[model samples]
Target chain A: MDTPHPGPDLHPHCTIVPPYLLVRLAKLDDPRFAQAAAAARESLLRDSQIRQLRGGEHPFTYSGARTLPARTPGESDRTISDAGGQERLPGRRVRAEGQPAGSDPAVNEAYDSLGATQALFWTQFGRDSIDGLGLPMDATVHYGKQYDNAFWDGERMVFGDGDGQVFNRFTISPSVIGHELTHGVTQFTANLQYEGQSGALNESISDVFGALVEQHTRGQSSAEASWLIGDGLFTDQVEGVALRSMKAPGTAYNDDVLGKDPQPGSMADYIETDDDNGGVHLNSGIPNRAFYLVADALGGNAWERPGRIWYNTLTGTGLGRESDFAAFAAATAATAAQLHGIGGAAHNAVLQAWVTVGVMTGRE
Target chain B: MKVIVSRSGGMAGIRLTWEVRVEEQPDPATWADFLNSLPWDDVTDSEAAPDRFAYRIRCAPHEVVLGETQVNGPWRDLVNRVRAANGM
Candidate 1:
């Protein structure tokens, strides 16, 4: 029997930090931030090269030299590798499934964060792994010389040690790990095109699940959660609480070297530009706030009701690769109404949340 | 001769710019020769990869946008020189 298959041909090089922020970091002339500047420039070059490799007409295919293990449902198999400051992936394997904690802090942190992310999906969404097929989760630490970003290259997650002056280890925040992994989930599900408003929605969906993973792990109510994306990723030297704030956009960071966060929380402040994949990271704040409002209005565990609505909309049939903010809002409201009764608290909450963020759900 | 290059696109979609006046260079003749040797006309417009960087070069009457991978030879050398001059 043929099983339901994931959609065709959409692979995005999803990264936790946007290139614009890195560009600012790269252009800093301050003596104190020189290392960060160099690292950011190197990351940009490497990222560009990787994108070129992945953007060919034919899909990337693996050779037959290596074989993957048989997938076991409901089991999580994780591997953490150490790159040893080289710009290579899945470097020397340092830790594996069922292995004891390693001596390296980065390795241990990556291992634990991967487990947390896996637990969140398994316990809440019934997703065994990124592909829901018990696909082995893998990560690499110490990716490059003072590398300042983390990314999911349509396969495994790669992280950098970061310039100690500006950023910390990518594995420091569990939500970041969840955020990157959710991209894999999206690749298998809606596979939203990573450009313009659709790209913003794609980013918002990851942030929503990323926040939920953190909240679920901490058992925090919607009111109690911080709603910050990369809360602890920034060093104390930077004048920032996190990379992006779901609760309040455009307020995550403001520093002499880092520049101000450009995220817009409402459609009124939406930016129109031809850069950063049409401002995916900047415009994501609108939908991020929408989800936050819905969770706040409903009260209680967000991953249960609000999270379910978002997840259903993501995996549901109506969601297309090019879905924009309005389309997503309507889908969520429809999902809420389907899960709950018409005009129920959940449905009204979803609609009101979208409207509060200046996005019409058209649920009337 | 005066040239301006604007680099945009990347994971974050931010834009960076650099401008150079050939006559103002410490060695004007050397800079002019360097600019003239570049294969500017050969840099064709191409589709950009999602979230990858692209560049726009505006040097007087000629203007062209090239994807990040298409930036090589003199294009890469010029961009690198500008970035180095800016202390990047």
Candidate 2:
């Protein structure tokens, strides 16, 4: 709680200066290095007190102003850290790439889940990592005290331990991990504005590939896959199977405390609201159901053609930052035609799925 | 004062809401002071982080939606105060 006042410059070298060195610098009695000492203290305070927002959510869609980190061009480079019940991020590195499994279940689960997501991208779409050039996939677990959420803070994934009353530990589900990691992928690519349809699309994209990651890992066919985004996250006390069900959007849960799942399966039922960033989480069910239909129709492995279409459309230059359901559907259809031929099964499936989901009227 | 605290937009995509009447609390003056002490006009309207817990805290004419990162310092104190008052 002893947060020091930030220095004039705001400590640009906080990352380079180790915490121990920063601590020593912060306590040094030198007047000349007062700014340096204050900067160190500010950095330390950031680590101690604040939950780093990082770029403050990039108010506008990326217009190529922000360049992602350079690629490593190999296997996934990962680092898992522990927040130790604090709101700080990347708290302390507990597991790194190629390290043996740690004793903490959350740490190991995070490590494995990240690897699975990386493997799905690489093995299926030739994507190297979240950014496709092998950007490191890192995560932080056990963040905050009984924290009930997991988020991608533009740079890395941060997970809460969950309240345990309604939700279990977040790391218990691989799909949740995949969902968070995909946000990084979205950030690097479409950079969808996190509001309204675009925000819902942002949420839906994460859920689509998220479920795919788990299915790819289980080697389950489309029918075998649960199509639920947070499968094991709910405690038995909560009357829910998962957070969002792609197969049946609003049917994921109906509880007294959590209330009925407010998601709509089609444009006919799309919710219009200002909360949750224009109901990004609620209206996402429309696209989510669309993706599910495509996967179900394709029938062997959902991540193959269906996954390729979604992934390509996301990474491809067809989408705008503010792409609506129709626009994204059109983009996906274009991708399907590009991947599979025009009038082909994959292309046809996408058309029918979008039309059925009311994302589009009909194929041109 | 009547205050509404609603959290939404996490990875779970769940929304939880609570309504608190400061007048009904043991100390109404402190609650008024607490609400006045917050920077209601300084809230950033954009999404702060993906899937991070955010709150829509409204007190009559003053209302703001804050991302988890913004819900620190005095913001955190206000939120915790509301939650504690609600017995959450």
Model 2's CAPRI class is medium
Off by over 4 Å in 1: A1-71, A361-364, B1-80
- Give the local distance difference test score of model 2: 0.82
Q: Considering summed lDDT, which 10 consecutive residues are worst modelled in model 1 chain A?
A: A57-66
How does residue A301 of candidate 2 score in lDDT? 87
Which one is best on lDDT? 2
Tens digits of per-residue lDDT, candidate 1, A1-364, equal 1121222212221112245545666788887666657766776767656447645211111121011234445577999999999877779999999999968988998888888888877776666678654668999999887766677777788788877888788778888888888877777667788878988888888889989989988999899999999889889998989888999999988888767888899999999986566778789999999999999998988888888788778876657668889889889999989988779999999999888888883545
lDDT of 2 at A189: 69
TM-score of chain B of each: 0.88, 0.90
For model 1 chain B, the run of ten residues with the poorest summed lDDT? B7-16
